[model samples]
Target chain A: MHLEEFAEGNSFIHKLDPRVKFLTVIPSVFAIAAMKTIAAPIAALIVCLILVILSRLDLKKLIIRLITVNVFIFFLWIFLPFSYPGEAFFQIGNLIATKEGLLHVLSITLKSNAIVLLTIVILGTSEVFSLSHALIHLKLPRKLVLLFFFFYRYITVMHDEYVKMKKAILIRCFKPKSNLHTYKTYAYLIGMLIIRSFERSQRIYNAMLCRGFKNNFPIISHFELKKIDIAFGIAMIIIFFSLIAVFENTFTQVPIWIYQKTLALVGQASRLS
Target chain B: MHISEGVLSPAVLIAGALLTAGGVAIGLKKMDYNKIPGVAVLSSTFFVASLIHIPVGPVSSHLILNGLVGILLGWMAFPSILVALFLQALLFQFGGLTTLGVNTLIMSAPAVIAFYLFSYLIKRGNNIITIVAGFLSGAVGVGLAGLFMGLSLLGTGEEFVNIVKLVIAAHIPVMLIEGLITAFCVVFLKRVKPEIVGA
Candidate 1:
């Protein structure tokens, strides 16, 4: 369903040379991941926010799309600290939770959020083709690149087929009453999907043979890097390093709720003293 | 179970990337280009498989048939899973670039082992054997992935074994279903599209 909605365009982010953006993303991801303290990620999060702004995407749509996936990951992030063991900050009722565990959970949450946000920034603005070329340039094997190319090309077709299958099942009022029944239905669906895809692959191979059967897929020939690409690359590196250098050690003020709790704790401690 | 970029240490991520690259090179060296489309189709199947969620009580879990891919594609599953994981990371944010190698290895290793061990079981027309292998392969793959993921948490400054238990426990049901599904899927392929199953 998501694949069908992917729109091709000449937007600015999409227009920037793919290599520059691709290279930029790696460092940004690395820097975001390497931050032992929260400040770097909060800053990286700000950068992601700025990129999102610059991309001119509809804010509501992007948030909805991201939140849909983040909801699942957030579940794990929220539960990890409580279930995990570490030094306790304090106790509530019978539970002994630690500030250390909370910090670890918060870091995981922030880091994952930063990565997702950066992905949205990168993919939301760039064309899939550019990314593929960047991968090829980055020295991924040719077959791997081609595999991605053809896979994306046919994924929309497979997705449509899946939708039709699901709709047909719905139309037939097919519903499984038990876990076993559901599992059977799903297994059968997977079987059918595989059979269908294999058949399509045969056709694709045949078509490739008919035109000019060669091992190598034809490479797209139109992506030449220019001055803009170089400038963007340079600018990205400078900004990323500058942020890391300036704020690498600063304490990230946790979100307002945590800050309030911490402040309250500090107040209580001072009173005790 | 894709670990995102910020989830791993730089040392581990870079080391994983290099190690995965080496594995990919070893895999590719023996592969023929003619088999590339088959790998692509299987990779696409993996992508689509992830989208198919079967509800388990209140929440639903999806099947990731990395084992099935491994059984069918052999070593090529590495690059195939790598590509699919990368795209999933980029498109759906299912995983991150930094942890791509680790995640790829996490899912692919079990599949490779499954292929070697289970390829023989496909004979004798024993559906049970096929099914059992599928189940074990899927379970083992995810189980191993969870274990390594838990181990990776050591660098994150967190408890290890408990995280392992949590991840492994959560995936148990899906692993069972994935095993059966892969088994039957293989049988079905053997019935109609035997060639695709590499029979």
Candidate 2:
């Protein structure tokens, strides 16, 4: 849950305006998702890897994050290959894995990994508060931005409160069993947590009011887009569109060539018979 | 039930985002200034609620508690769920940025439904009826969320029947567990702090 662990870096990727990075990364993700051919996602994945390297993210942490994202994709591969109907590429006993199914899995895997990597390289290098500020700069609603700020500030505090409650339960020798007692205990635990958090919220509200709190979040830092950020944005758009064009042409031509070859074989067989 | 990026078509994503934006706007408008801290606190609780594993018979499931949020916050559930989901995506990558709209809709829409269906019963009923209403709200909230999650996956070319059956089947245990949790919370609040329950 340590999302901003990499935000302290002085790397080039870290130095770019959060808004520029956000704009660039979101479109690239959309492009990857919209891609019809596997090649585009593969190309996107490579681009993301290059960005990750440039960002100088810790290799171990990056791998752990990648694994978490890929685990769901791994489950998709297990089910989708058998469920999607297409040319059977292989069979084991009764189950058949189709070519289209495998391609589906590959596409999702590549697209998801590419996006996750880009997110880690781009948004991961910026603080959440700065990102919220950038969103505000982009004309996102004031209320939504404030929500993000409060959510970010108190997520850890609430987590610690839950942990403390869990510890208290454990201290009383609460063993988790497959019985009603365990369920009720957990229910009560959650109930207690909710109640405590609510009471704390009232106190927090009172404290904020005492300090002349307003609905507006005071902005401290301003983002200025540098020349490198503009260059990065242009490069992303160019690579994105070129990959789309190249892959779309290649994928479109491939099916037509296969259809023609099949027709030729069918014609030849009929003539010989 | 978080849908990863690239799983949904562009049209679905855009539609989900637009609907969610509207929901959040309504939620913000309805929220009082004094209640912002409460919403923030609940939002943070929700962000961590997913990490709290509840033991259900032989298996353990994480708490979503959207029903609790719904019954307590009403229209504010939209913005509350949005912030919680945003943090979840940022911190754990539970859902992707591209699919945030879809995920928010899948989770919070059901919560709003639960509020309308059961919040009145919890407010006006006796203790036993209140608990039952709370349980039903929690279970239905989860069931509707599962249905919505399945619907969102329709763009993947899967049959609606099969996806719904699968999603609901996976969530059955969660529904029961959350029901018990929500019921207990409701009952406890009624006894000790009845005013906060808005009863």
Candidate 3:
């Protein structure tokens, strides 16, 4: 029910240009992903945490979101320590936890949290519609942007229809058990939803034709970059670029002479595992 | 399931982004202006449908009907899924920005594969064949997606080999459920609105 809850704020982040937010957040996320050590992601995570706190988002909602994101991480933790073969960090009755595995999972955890938080703080702080508009400004295909706009516009309508259908079925004592009946019911529900959408699109298309429909959907508004927006963009670019620089032997920048050395290291490491 | 951001190595991320861009380009090229509303609304419907949670015990799992999307839209499932995921990221934060390309590829590539593999049967075949094709499409959609997600995870290191297997194993139930649901859905569509199945 609380769509774009993070976007509805008077904070400085909310006021920043969506274009800048898009341009900066993407590279920063990739940078966080590429970090080889935990320290860098921890730093990035701390920065994002501060930004989110400053943005005045509802902590309850943010906590829920973070918990959902961590579910995947939680799964990683379960099998990784016992399954990854390496120097033993600890021992259970028959289970062995590897030092390398724990470190790797920890790094993944930090980087994942940092990247998700950064994305929420930056791109998520703007209305999704505005972000679509910004995608056009960022040189994404206009057709894709228009599609995104139209998709978001109709999603709520379809959801309302879905809720109504669910209510009707619930009133009919439709209990969703793990059975053929439940599956069939859901299939019917989806089938009905699709049929309605297809039918409604016909009317929508006809209405547009009546209103002088064209192939192109043109925007009435364009983005105007402000000084503050540019300044924030530059600051973020530097921060993220520096984060990317922290990896001394990351994939993209391995020196040619050290290539064989790194390859040898990889071979040795593989042997260890 | 959407692989969260920052989990994949850059190599996998870049590969996913490139493939997704190529798929989206083909989809856009095939799509004309008039079909925009139809594609948008259809994808929106799928987006809403994904929220339906069926009880699997004490826990419930939401639907991932990429097979249905692929059958409905064919190649256009690419852009449709891309937009849906972007909305999910923006609205629910189910996935994040960095992993957008990878997640989109994970879901939609299988969708495209399912379309090619099963759409023909669903269109031209009789009731039993249609149901069988629908089941295959649904199962293949999630099955291939689970495989692709595992491969993407493997890009991080061989350490994730166990996780990769687990990820694929975990999807078996969903695949079965999706197969059944999709089979019935296709049958229903064939009965109620035959042309809407793919026309």
Q: Global lDDT of each model?
A: 0.72, 0.82, 0.86
Model 3 clashing-pair count: 0
- Candidate 1 vs 2: which has more lDDT: 2
Task: For candidate 3, write residues A1-273 as lDDT tens digits.
Answer: 456778888899989989888888877777787787877888788889988988888789888888988998999898788888789999988989999889888998998888778778887788878898788878898789889989989988998999999999999999989888888999999999999999999999999999896755577877789998999888877876676566434545667768889899999999999
Question: What is the model-wide C-alpha lDDT for candidate 1?
Answer: 0.72
lDDT of 3 by residue, B1-199 (tens): 8988767888988899899999999999988888899999999899888888987657678899999889988889999999999887776667777778899999999999999999999999998999999999999999999999998888867878888988888899889989899999999998999988752
TM-score of each: 0.86, 0.91, 0.94
- Cα-based lDDT at residue A183, candidate 3: 86
> Candidate 2's error at B92, in angstroms?
2.1
RMSD of each: 8.4, 6.4, 3.9
For candidate 1, what is the TM-score?
A: 0.86
Residue A214, model 3: Cα distance from true site in angstroms = 3.1
Residue B183 lDDT, candidate 1, scale 0-100: 70
Model 2: per-residue lDDT, tens digit, A136-237?
A: 888887777777788778878888888888899899999887676876787677667677778998998898888888877666667787899999988987
In model 2, the runs with Cα more than 4 Å from the true position are: A1-3, A249-273, B159-164
The most accurate candidate by lDDT is 3
For each candidate, report its DockQ versus the true two-chain complex: 0.48, 0.51, 0.78
Pick the TM-score winner.
3
Better of 1 and 3 by DockQ: 3
